[model samples]
Target: MAKEQHKTNAMRTLDATGARYEARFFDCPEALSGVEVARRLGIDEDRVFKTLVTEGRSGAHYVFMIPVACELDLKKAAAAAGEKAVAMVRSRDLLPLTGYVHGGCSPIGMKRLFPTAIDETCDLHERIAFSGGRIGCQIEMAPDDLARVIPLSRADLIVL
Candidate 1:
């Protein structure tokens, strides 16, 4: 018998929006680095994106998605969000702010829809993968499909 698929808020949000996506699950009881996740799933690290939450100087939160292997450039992120500066939100504050734990954060279905940006590199891929609002699951879909569900701006968010 096949394992039952776990439904997540992110998945449900996509479903409500009529977005097409594929869910990939793995045995990850503990948090793993993004590169490790890509390796375990046999996906190119560049095709696996990480969702990052940051607070602008004005105290507004913002979301950014970038390739797992790359580092988010704070200056660029701030620029994209139209803030004087931005800093990553505290790990402990993540759950209360976004309704997600540190490693399982997803761009979709957050506690609130904050201003969001996707790394320009995403345009190079036909599909990208991100957390499915849980530790062991990932959602894969075309970038355009994701944008249709969540408003997203394209920016150069990663370190070169």
Candidate 2:
């Protein structure tokens, strides 16, 4: 049997919203891409989402959720966020800005709420997984349930 993982801030927030989710942990000796993580978890890469932080031209912060197998289309992302342009937040700035590290960022809980968007493709899956606020930890739940836990919009944020 797998050991129960401790609750993370993200998990606590999800619980507060009464959203159901499964928290899991996987061995992560090296920082791995979301795709690799999903592969190791024996799940479809499309069902595993990665949380990304980006800064708009106006200096406003934004968050995006996309499948591990796809890349965020900066142009499409900016359009979805109603920004003139946007760029990924520097790795070092992730923790200070969102209170999450590079490999463990979660769209669910951040230091402050930012405008967030998830790839519309998420709707294709009944359940999706994302980092559980820590590297090596993951949380799986319905996309709609995740939306209820946090204000999020679904859009074409991924590169086709």
Candidate 3:
């Protein structure tokens, strides 16, 4: 007998779009930082991204993806989203707003498709990895393929 794999909403969404992706799973019982995840997966931190949700001054929600080793510059992010300012949504509000718990949020399959931006640095990579809509899983795919699944703009979003 073999164990059946559990498909997350993110994985299902990718399947529906016919996007090419690789689902990688590791032993993670609780939430961990992106860098930690990369370390556990024996992957380069630069190729791993972390999803962040923020609320703009206009009350609009936005998503940003940046390399695990970098930090999101709020000012740059706001500029990318065309907002006066943006602040990270509280962890308690993540589930209700994005249908994903902290540390498990993926840019795809959110409760709603919010404005999304990926750091321009992502373009430098042939492929990138992000949360697979769960704490213990990851999804790796080409940047262009991800853009085909979700409408996103590339911007300089990381701190200098």
Candidate 4:
């Protein structure tokens, strides 16, 4: 028998949006960073993205996706988001704000649809991977497809 796959909220959202993706699962009972996740999954770090939740000066929340190995450039992100300044939300507020835990936040299914931006580097790959709204699962799909599922725009959000 094949191992059963857990369908996360992220996956379900993708299905509802008719987005195409391949789910990837790994053993992770504890929270792990995006780079660690890519290493464990044996995928290139550049092709793995991490979801970050930030609050702008106006107190509105925003989401940004960047490559696992890179950091989000606050200045660039703020500029792209048209916010005077932005800072990451506390980890404790993650679940309540996004309906996702620290390591399992996916850009696809958030509690509310916040303005989202993805690093322009994602365009270099035909497909990229992101958390599947769960700690041990991930979803791989074309960047264009992801934009269809989420109201996202791509920009130079990553730090040089």
Overall lDDT per candidate, in order of appearance: 0.93, 0.91, 0.94, 0.90
In order of appearance, the predictions have TM-scores of 0.97, 0.95, 0.97, 0.95
C-alpha RMSD of candidate 4:
1.9
* Candidate structures ordered by lDDT, highest first: 3, 1, 2, 4
Candidate 3, 80: how far from true, in Å? 0.3
Q: What is the C-alpha lDDT profile of model 1 across 1-160, one tens digit per residue?
A: 1134688889989888888999888999888999999999999999999999999999999999999999999999999999999999999999999999988999999999999999999999999999999898899999999999999999999988
lDDT at residue 25 of model 2 (Cα atoms): 90
Q: Give each model's clash number.
A: 0, 0, 0, 0
lDDT of 3 by residue, 1-160 (tens): 1123668889999988999999899998899989999999998999999999999999999999999999999999999999999999999999999999999999999999999999999989999999989899899999999999999899999999
Candidate 1, residue 96: how far the Cα is off, in Å = 0.4
Write down the worst ten-residue block by lDDT for model 3. 1-10
For every candidate in turn, the CA RMSD to the true structure comes to 1.9, 1.8, 2.1, 1.9
Instruction: Please give the TM-score that candidate 3 achieves against the real structure.
Output: 0.97
Instruction: Give per-residue CA lDDT, model 4, range 32-58, as digits (tens).
Output: 989999999999999999999999999
Candidate number that wins on TM-score, 1 or 4: 1
Candidate number that wins on lDDT, 1 or 2: 1
Model 3, global lDDT: 0.94
Q: Of the candidates numbered 3 and 4, which has the greater TM-score value?
A: 3
